[model samples]
Target: MHIGIVGAGLIGVATARELSRRGHRVILVDPEPLSGATHAAAGMLAPVAEVTYDQDDLYPLMATSARMYPDFLAGIEADAAYRTTETLVIAADAADREFLATLAEFQRRMDMECEVITTRAARALEPNLGTAIAGAVRIPGDHQVDPRRLGSALLAQVLQSGGEVRRTRVKAIEEENGPILRLAEGEDLRVDHVLVANGLNAAELVDLPIRAVHGDVIRMMMPAHRDHLITSTVRAMVQGRPVYLVPRADGSLVLGATSREDDLTGVSAEGVFQLLRDAHRILPSVWECEITELTARARPASGDDVPIIDRVADHISVAAGFSRHGILLAPIGAQLAADVVLGEGGNGPLAQSVRLGRFNHSPLEHSTRK
Candidate 1:
């Protein structure tokens, strides 16, 4: 089957890769390719640290995806040689420290393995930490991947598998027994199946209540902190707000992120300042690192903050609404979507709930993606 894929972010690329692996011809359509949230993301596969109020459905999917990372990265890293290791979540302030304490207790109650260390012990793990820091929690299962490298790796895999990638924006999908997609400049292409994996643009295709939530993050080029197991993902609440500092193997520290619901994608000075201020508060030693770049990207947020991954029709399917968990859910989302497209049944929970037509109650009857 010839499959049409919209958007070339991580999800799109992963979906295309999965389909191609299953011997299906894939045509990926996107303008920027990997330069979306997948580009700006810190690439922390931390479902535990990322847990909020009470979203248990997402955790199962996240854990499944997180478990899949080992094998996924093994193949990608064998080709790309990107680093994947443990991550640390830290708390520097009093209030934030208390929050970490609560998180630690919750982890204990849940029978999860995480370590709560003192300020000195935390500093021992990350020597750059500020002396005024309170303490930290280490989640060994939480890992990191270079998003840029991962994107490049996935794109390489797709191209190597004889998949076609078009650098054009897909405007809409037309149904003709199967599905036909309309690209930029009024170009029309026909395919046996169509999948929408573009983050925010999927909403425009389907009338889902998905909106883009903007987050600004700054990347700094600092001294290489490899060889040391200070390798846990560190996150803390700086000044009554949540902030995270993710360290890379190549001595780069990703300091992020400020959540703004505005639709703007431009990197703002204020956003960079907020990241720097939080980074300084969390780890004062990073103040000397050179500011490499500041980036702002919107994460696709749905009403329930969970992805909808079901088919809209026999030939048309949607796979957006991943929000911040796109990276964590990429593998399962792509695999299940590919299985569905290939006429293989799927028992995945996400495949059942992420339907494009699930939320429509208007007079329009069914959801349309044209």
Candidate 2:
């Protein structure tokens, strides 16, 4: 089967790789591959720390993907530079500590492994932690990965598996004979199946209930003397604003992010200032780090905040609305999309769980495609 993937972010690349490995011809189309939300993402695989009380349904998908990371990276030819570091969910003050404690209780009720520790014990693990922190929750199962590396590795795998890559934006998709991908350069290529894995731009091709949720992220370089300053990912509720610092193998730290729905106005000064200020509160050493890059990208999100993976049309499959969990959920979502493309019948539960038909109205009603 020849498959056409409309996005080159983590989801598209992973889906292409999966399809290519399964003996399908895949052509990934994207104008700026890996430059979207995947590039700005911190790549923290923290299903335990990321669980919200209201979004219990999303935990299974995230946990499944998180568990698949080791095998997923093993199969990829290019190294994605994954790290199985534990995560520390710290609290700045008493109120924040209570909040995390409540969350920890919920996690425990859900049969998740998490340890509530005192500030002293938390500081023992991370000595650089500010004295003002009240408590922390140790989530040993959470991990991190380099999304840029993952994208590169997936691209390499796709190419090695005889898949094609077109460095152009898809103008539209028409289903005359099959799915026709009208390229931005005035070329039309028809394929057996079309997977709309593009992030926020997916709405332009299909009438999916996908919207762009903008996030601002900051990348900083750790000084030579302070290399590997924080071994594990640190997520804290600093004055009720969620901030996290994910350290990379290259001695760089990713600090982010401010979630603002429908705000496409790039990174702002206030966002940067808040991130830096909260990051400094968690680890004071961040004050001396070199400010490297400030970026913003819109994550494709749905009303439920869970991903949508279903066959929206006879020849078109929609895989979008991953929100901030794109990197974490890419493997599973890719497999689901690939299964749908291959006409697999046993994926009924998986398909129904994220099916677009769950919505009241068809996404086609809102599609911008001609």
Error of 2 at 260 (Å): 1.2
Cα misplacement distance, residue 43 of candidate 1 (Å):
0.5
What's the lDDT for candidate 1? 0.77
Q: After aligning candidate 1 to the native by TM-score, how far in Å is the CA of 128 from where it should be?
A: 1.5
TM-score of each prediction: 0.92, 0.97
lDDT of 2 by residue, 1-370 (tens): 8899999999999999888878889999998888999999999998999998798669988888888888889866534478888999999888899999999999999988999998899899988889888789999999999888888988888888798889999999887877899999899998999999897888789877878888889998989886578988999999888999999888999999698874555897788899999989989999889989999988889888889988777888888999999999988988888888787747555566788777775866544365
Distance from true location, Cα of 124 in model 1, Å: 1.4
Q: Model 2, clash count?
A: 1
Lowest summed-lDDT stretch of 10 residues in model 2? 361-370
Q: How much does candidate 2 score in TM-score?
A: 0.97
Local lDDT at 160 for model 2: 83
